[model samples]
Target: MKAYIAIKYHINLENKELIEEISNALEVNKIKSCCIIRDKEEWGRKTFSVEELMSISFKEIEISDFIVVDLSEKGVGLGIEAGYAYAKGIPIITIAKEGKDISNTLKGISKKIYTYEESSDLVNYFKRLKETSIIHNSI
Candidate 1:
């Protein structure tokens, strides 16, 4: 089973590296992502667009078995995606940077939030999430 990962793209040049680093981690782990990129028709920042696109993305994500989120930046969009996935009855896997705090909206998620200090941490967390999702679907 595949998973859709929601991540925030930091607009700052310095933080853009952070976005790419995190996105690469998702690809390396083979978790499908809900990241939005440049397009003439697309307006607003990547994370900001989540509020507008959550329902649409949720339909695509629901095609898969689970949803994983990167809440390192604590963007509102990640929260929107997480909530949508939760409401859709899909299991949620949250990945947060080691020093970051899980937002109030995401704090109460029943499943454990995998915390990562580096890209490697993200990779390992995704592996665990994938295996758990596979087992969950089998039952």
Candidate 2:
């Protein structure tokens, strides 16, 4: 199934390397994924108001089949995307650091959340999830 990768994209990810790791995971899974900054230009704000952002975000989530989200860093936008996916009846795979408080808004929805302590673990998680899904469906 196609998956949309939702992450905190407003920040410069060049230094983080986590985004690249996640991108590779998505591609290796042969899953179609789009980053949150899909249309944004570098080095400046995109000039969108809150309502407009939500509208576009909701639209994208509706078009996508499932959400694979990175909540390694907390952000209001990521929370919104998580909520949007849940409300739209899309399956969710969320990754967050261990011990971080999942916002109440996100917890309200039952998601198959995972935690990754390292980048390698993140890749492993993707591989395992995909394999498990294949097995589950063949039953």
Q: Candidate 1's residue-wise lDDT over 1-139, tens digit each? A: 4566577644454455555566566678775454453221132343444444655676666775667677777667777778877777787777777888887668686366777777667666666655666426532
Candidate 1 TM-score over all chains jointly: 0.69
Query: Candidate 2, which ten residues in sequence have the lowest lDDT sum?
Result: 38-47
lDDT of 2 by residue, 1-139 (tens): 5667777765455423676677677778676666556543222346466677677778778877778777777777777788778877787777777776666656566356777777667667777877878313422
- TM-score of model number 2: 0.76
| Cα misplacement distance, residue 96 of candidate 2 (Å) | 1.0
Q: Per-prediction TM-score, please? A: 0.69, 0.76
Quote the lDDT for 27 in model 2. Answer: 71
| Candidate 2 lDDT (Cα, 0 to 1) | 0.68
Superposition error at 139 for model 2 (Å): 16
Indicate the residue-level lDDT of 18 in model 2: 71
Error of 2 at 26 (Å): 1.5
**Model 2: CA > 4 A from native:** 14-16, 38-52, 134-139
